[model samples]
Target chain A: MIIDPSIIIIEGLKKIIESGPEFKITRFYQSNSITTNVLLHGIDILLVNPRMSKTSQFTKFIHDCRTENENMVIFALQTSYVPMQMMNLVDGVIEMDDDPSVIISKLRNVSCKTESANLSDNCELSSREKEVLVLVAKGKTNKEIAELLNLSVYTVIAHRKNITAKTNIKSVSGLTIYALLNNLISQTEMN
Target chain B: MNKFTGRNKFIELLNYNPQLILMLPRFGMKLGFGEKRVEDICEMNNVSSFMFLLLCNVYSFDDYMPTENEIKDIDANALVKYLIASHDYYLNHRLKHIEKHIGKIAKEAGKIGDVLLNFFKEYESEIATHFKTEEDTIFPYLLSENKQMIPENIDLDTLSRSHGNIGDKLSDLTNIIIKYLPAEIMPNERIGVWFDIIQLSKDLDKHTIVEEKILMPYIEGVKGGSL
Candidate 1:
């Protein structure tokens, strides 16, 4: 069976979309008719938030087009409290406030398990270790980390050990540089 | 309070003296202090306390801080306890837990997120020490009426040193989260983790506030002197 393209979200919501799923995503500008037409024909999912700056008529047109086709799953984004009745219009509503990871999980739950299958192999970093690495990347030394969390230096070193063991990047400086490159820490973090 | 993002105020304070982060080791070297002092500096700089203890106990980063022979010479259990309680229990657990569920989910999603899981492995011990430090040290000191019952070991000067390191940890962690997880549009759960991390850091800040605003004053009042 052919796997469908993961998502086609409206442009302004791209950050939310990007942060949500670790999958391939295409975006459509609010006014781009050809992009909308192509998205309707292709992607497996369409995520839109009505509160976008797009005109109501354009929004209506996109809605009409999406309603006519059932192949693509349409999700209307809402804040935490939209009326329950309005949710029936789309495949579902993803709360604007929902965790991006949660959204991805929900999408994966509905779609397929293929994406989750390979992630473990890609990084091999644990959640806490990743957190530590990200901080190391940002250039926080061991003592600073310890104090901020009310810990001693020894524990922070253990995390560094774990980070190095998993990532195969040995030095703290190297880890910091790596994190910065990976978008794990910002440049200003060196401060 | 403009949506309190979870940066450590100490690190933010250090940002004013960006050079302090670098001066740590040099100072450690200059003082000719033991592994504990170096570890304290590292702790003050936001290095992972969990990892630091492991390294000291395991003698991993032997080249930089205390030589293996030097650490071997010390009272091993006391040093180990110092490493574990001060670093792992106090710092790493809190910082890592601050990450909350979204970070957990992101870790699960990212496949490389074993850090989140490892934190669970060390959670109980870390939290125990954290609470113990406050309850055993600060609380009794603050609540004490009779001078004899109060422990001199839990003084503000000592806590302030710890606060310095913890503050640094907060700053570094905040910097990492802000860089990796930009605040554009995150899923609510991921946002929750960010918020949790922030809140936990804020809790530390509040703890410090208690030390500075409330606890310290009482201690001072009782002592009839300045901290």
Candidate 2:
């Protein structure tokens, strides 16, 4: 599913995606036309513009979308710049300038990664590590995380390093996306 | 007379470089000084007096050169913190504001808008990724007292190369906006977006230079136990 207000770009992107037989556009929606109910239907992947609507409204839309479909791989269709407001809202970003081949590969990779995260029983994160991961994903600093988790600052740092080593996601944003994909942190909790 | 001496002189420095306002809070200082001299304020905040003077010189006069004693007294950690704050200003505030302007311009451009917007987005992503590397990797390494924890392949030159690429992309976007885009629709808005891009480009260049010339060398000195 692709939801961009620009119909021209939507058509262009759709044409590009349809070039590969493996991918299909489930639905197309203008920014204003999309409602919560439409998002309730099963969607494997959703590509949306962060500025499709006002920031608050779009954030609500994302939250509702996540609530409706927990496993939907949501990628922000970056049109102008990196949307910091949408950073915690989406799983990843897919730039509009990306080649069709790159888009297809990214879609495939995200889909597979999300599926594996959901299905994998061997997620080796300890309970404390999981707690730290959630806080880190929520943008808590090491000191804040220490205070929250009742651990020393060094311990929090160590736990974070271990979490990074285990997940192989270096940055907080990457960890946030990972947490969302794996359902470790829900969209509501993120807010 | 040193320009970084009295409280009034500090206020004058702030007027000269308004962007230095962002650095005040990091030092636990604020505007509207009552009776504090620059050295006194630095002492109150536990910040190095010489380091603050060096910053004032570097920011106020582009051609200013640091004395050996001043260079020796410079704290790399403080510099890293200042750099991180500047990055926050760029990523969180300036870039977000500029993006809103670009959004308006894109809406007005119609079909060609998507192409131009995409070009800008690509550039934005590159810069975000570059900052992420510094924030996640470089800054942490510099802050950490443990030298062994520093990654073996973390070369400053390699990182600086990407900074060049970011500048190039910004220039490309600026050119595209100025030359290729149709001027009939929302010309003022388009020019406003371009102006923001230009400002960002200049700021980024200064930032890169600071990191490459000052911060990187300082870190290398510390790594070698020379600082």
lDDT of 1 by residue, A7-58 (tens): 2333324555566544445324332232222223325566655443235443
lDDT of 2 at B219: 65
Q: What is the lDDT, from 0 to 100, of the residue B212 in candidate 1?
A: 44
Model 1: CAPRI class: incorrect
DockQ for every prediction shown: 0.01, 0.01
* Alpha-carbon lDDT of model 2: 0.70
Each candidate's B-chain TM-score, in sequence, is: 0.43, 0.84
How well does candidate 1 reproduce the true complex, by DockQ?
A: 0.01
TM-score winner: 2
lDDT of 1 by residue, B61-135 (tens): 111223233333333233223333433433555554654553555464343244323333344344445556766
